[model samples]
Target chain A: MNTLDARGYSCPEPVIMTKKALEKGLPLTVMVDGVTPLNNITRFAQNKGYKVESRAVGEDYELTISK
Target chain B: MKNKQTLLIAATGLVVGALAVLLTLNGNPANMGFCIACFLRDTAGALGLHKAAVVQYARPEIIGLVLGAFIMSVAGKEFAAKGGSSPMTRFVLGFFVMVGALMFLGCPLRMVLRIAGGDLNAVVGLIGFVCGILGGIFFLKNGFTLKRTYTLSRLEGTWMPILSLGVLALLLLAPSLLAFSESGPGSMHAPVMMAQAAGLIVGALAYKTRLCMVGGIRDAVLFGDFYLLYGFVAIIIAALIGNLAIGSFNLGFDGQPVAFNDGLWNFLGMALTGLGSALLGGCPLRQLILAGSGNSDSAVTVMGMIVGSAFCHNFGLASSADGPTSAGKIAVIIGFAVVIVIGLANMRKEKV
Candidate 1:
């Protein structure tokens, strides 16, 4: 399992980073501070044959993606 | 389920409009909230690139927008620097786009903003913008392309962002280092903190959605894709709602602030904007975002805008409410010719 912390960053980037992590064929936990990125990363993963589960951790979100 | 994406995008549009209205209510000019071209021109004037007294301010919103976008790009691990995609051509297109935008006194964002605030003058500019986009679509159909940009070192992408941060710092710590207008639009601004927050939100959301108003219209025209247009439409709806709530909605052509009454040039001005921006492959806002994200080609285009603004101001090529200066009208004609030539020259023909 890998942790991808993308807190305080905006979209496209977090999603872009999440895409890279998913491409590594590993289960990953992604932290995103922005609502836009949280939804975007989850959508990108779900669309790419991965299951995504996200939970709020304080003001940020933690998203889990696994094949 | 089907409208999920549309709803999501429209939400971002709503945020954009909300902030824009908030800024206007907080002392930003009426019908002049968040114009990339105007802000860029004002920035250039602030730097003494052109001695335009009435429009000189190192707008923190512009700095914050680029800086915010750049920060996001880096945080997302997507800040790759690249360029050489007909950079000079892009610069020229950016230049003319600025020329056209200033002549009419706004960008596509401002055009929509104006309409949202009930200025009918923008209605004409909107028509011109559509037509200009149609012209670009014609060239696109004809195989006109500015080519592609290749990846460069990551450090290369840091320059513009660094520059923006530097500007932000200077504006904050050393106020006298940069010029600020004592009157006119340059002098008008929302509180610095509010402006920066608005710009940051907009920059970040735009990055996430890949929102491009011109792209939305172009996609709708080219491929019947209304996905993006939904977001564009949402901005207007949200803006109108915001303006009404703030008691800023005017509802007419007469007495619109920072807007010209001339219909034809308004049409032609935005026609030039639409065509040039279409040819350059993005609106002024998109260009700023792209530059922030480390695309040097876009950086070049941004520079072109700055230079274009200076040239327009120095050469008497910008229009005002009284109407376009004769020089501005002449520039628009020349601008059309330059853009058409660029279009024809770049277009490649497929062999049957």
Candidate 2:
């Protein structure tokens, strides 16, 4: 499982990073610092047919994407 | 609870729209109150960045907007110094967005106001604007991004707000240092204190509500989210009623104040504005609000807009009531090409 830290980033950046990382294969965990990114990444990953499990990590969110 | 929040946001829009009308009635340009692009152009002219004498005036509203957002964000504990994601790119995009806006003689907010005043040409511009947003959404769906931003020291984020204060001081204490338009659109303005108060109220509300015309349409198209769109709709309704009551609602393409009847240029201009704004992650007004809240990237974007405003007026690329200049048309085309190239270059490479 590869972890991608997308904290401290704004919208579309986190989603784009997630898309780029997904090209290599799934079971990836992405860390984001805001709700906008969390919802956006979840939507993007789900649209790509990936299962996304998101959980709160204190003030941030951890989203795990797997096929 | 959500309904209350929605009602509050709608009320905010109504207040903004009504204030725009009031500002216009008090001497701001007709159907031209609260235009970020036009006001910025005037600010650039006042600073002597451009020799467009008719448009020179250091608008107090802009200064007030920055300070208002700064104060609001600080009070809300939402002010954090952060930036460093493709500053130059945002600068260029901001420049092009100004070009497109000046070509159309307004920003999206003004476009809405124009429609509320029954300017049919703005309807044409609106069509183009939506088309441009759709084009941007295509790129966004394919993973367009400006990359990551990093948090910076608090001092770094205070520069824009400080600059705003400095400008305000100059406007109030040293009026001789800035140019004032003797005639034309620049000369027409509400009283200084009134304009400043209007900007402060609108800016604080916008900051609280996250009101953005570009975000409104983009979210609606991309996510089926109408939360942002509702604010704009409220603005339209509120402004429409105000314009009608004030007898300012003139329905025609000709003889509209501070506007031209060139439909093609109007469409292309706003199209460029919409696409550039969509790619930049915010519109001109949003950029200002963000800069107020300590985003240096948005500050840089605002600087780009000022320079672009100067460039438009200096080179005669900005339109006038007479119509769009040939040079203005060419510049808009170049702006599109440059923005497209930037958008293409920044996207993540697809797997081979």
Candidate 3:
């Protein structure tokens, strides 16, 4: 289970980073701070054949992307 | 991925545009909403680069944009501090982009906003922009290139943002360091916090999507891709709705605020802008965003635009409601010739 910290970041960068991580064939947890970034990361994962489930805990978001 | 990107871009455009309309309603200026070149000119004037009294303000929006993008880029771990991509060439390109935009009284973003607000003059400008883009495409196909940029220290990317924050500090604590117009276009602005917020949000969004009108059109033209264009189309539609809600929609061409009816200059001016922006690789707003993202080449371009703005106003080369001065006409003509020469001279040899 790999963990990626993408908190405090903005949009496309988080999404791009996530894509790179996925390409290396790793499935795990990604953290995004903002609603925009969280949503974008989720979609970027899903569109690339990954399953995404997200949870918000007190203003921070954790996304689990899996095959 | 493509569809989601389009949706995000559209959503960003809608919200940002609504803010622009709201700002205009709050006394920023009609059809004069969210113009990068105008704001740059105003900032240049504020810094005493030129003496255009009516158009001098260190727009908080521009500062916010740079800083916000800086913050996001740093946090995203996507910040690359590099440049040196033909700085002088880019500077001249920025100068001409601003000149062309000023002649038409707006950048491509503002052009769409204007037309959405019902300014018909922008249609002609649009035509010119497309033609210029077509010319630029001709050069690109013929191997026009600006060569590769060498990477520099990450500290290089930090300079633009650091400078932005310092300016923000100055604007907040020691306003006397910079000159602000007591009246005229410079005096007109949305509230500081509001403009800054708008700029910050936009900077963040732009950094993410890499939203660029010139890039979008260039892609659409050269590669037959509409992914970028979709975002722009959504922006216009969103702006149109915003204008409609506020009764800012004035369909006819004449009597548009801060703009006049000389259609030829409108066309020619935007043509210059289109070509210049294409040659330079992005529009003025994109340049600002890229500067925030740590591109030093873009920083030089921004500086070029600032100086060009000063030159235009100081030399009586900017157009007014009475229409373009003869000097402005001559400058536009010269701008076209110079841009064409740049396009032609910069072409690379075809590969074997």
1 versus 2: better TM-score goes to: 2
lDDT of 3: 0.80
Instruction: List where candidate 3 sits over 4 angstroms from the true fold.
Output: A1-67
Tens-place lDDT digits, model 1, residues B1-352 = 3267778778888888888888899888897778998999988988889888988988878887788788777788667677777889889999999999998899999998999999999999999999999998888776666764566787777777888888788888998978899998889999988898888888877766667778778767764556567778888998999999989999888789898799999999999999998887778988888889888888899999999999999999988667789999999999999999999998767510
* Estimated TM-score for each candidate: 0.83, 0.90, 0.83
- Stretches of candidate 1 off by over 4 Å are A1-67, B1-4
Question: Residue-wise lDDT of candidate 3 within B1-352, one digit each (tens)?
Answer: 6577778887777766777787788767786658888888888887889997889888888898888788888889767665777789999989988889889888888887888888899989889999988888788767666765555788887777887887788778988988888987789888888888888888888777767778678767764545557667777887788889988899988998777789999999999999999888778888898888788888899988988899999998898777888888888999998999998888767610
**Candidate-wise lDDT, in order:** 0.82, 0.88, 0.80
Tens digits of per-residue lDDT for model 3 on A1-67?
Answer: 8777766433333554565566656677888755556766765566567798889866568998888
Q: List iRMS for all predictions.
A: 11.5, 4.7, 11.0
Clashes of each: 1, 0, 1
Question: What digit string (tens of lDDT, one per residue) describes model 2 on residues B46-112?
Answer: 9899999899998888887888889999998778788998999999999999999999999999999
TM-score of chain A, model number 1: 0.90
User: Cα deviation of B301 in candidate 1 (Å)?
Assistant: 0.5
The CA lDDT at B183 in model 3 is 80
In terms of lDDT, model 1 sits at 0.82
> Which CAPRI quality tier does the interface of model 3 achieve?
incorrect
Of the true interface contacts, the fraction found in model 3 is: 0.00
Q: Please give the RMSD of candidate 2 to the true structure.
A: 3.4
Alpha carbon deviation, residue B187, candidate 2 (Å): 0.4
- Decreasing DockQ order of the candidates: 2, 3, 1
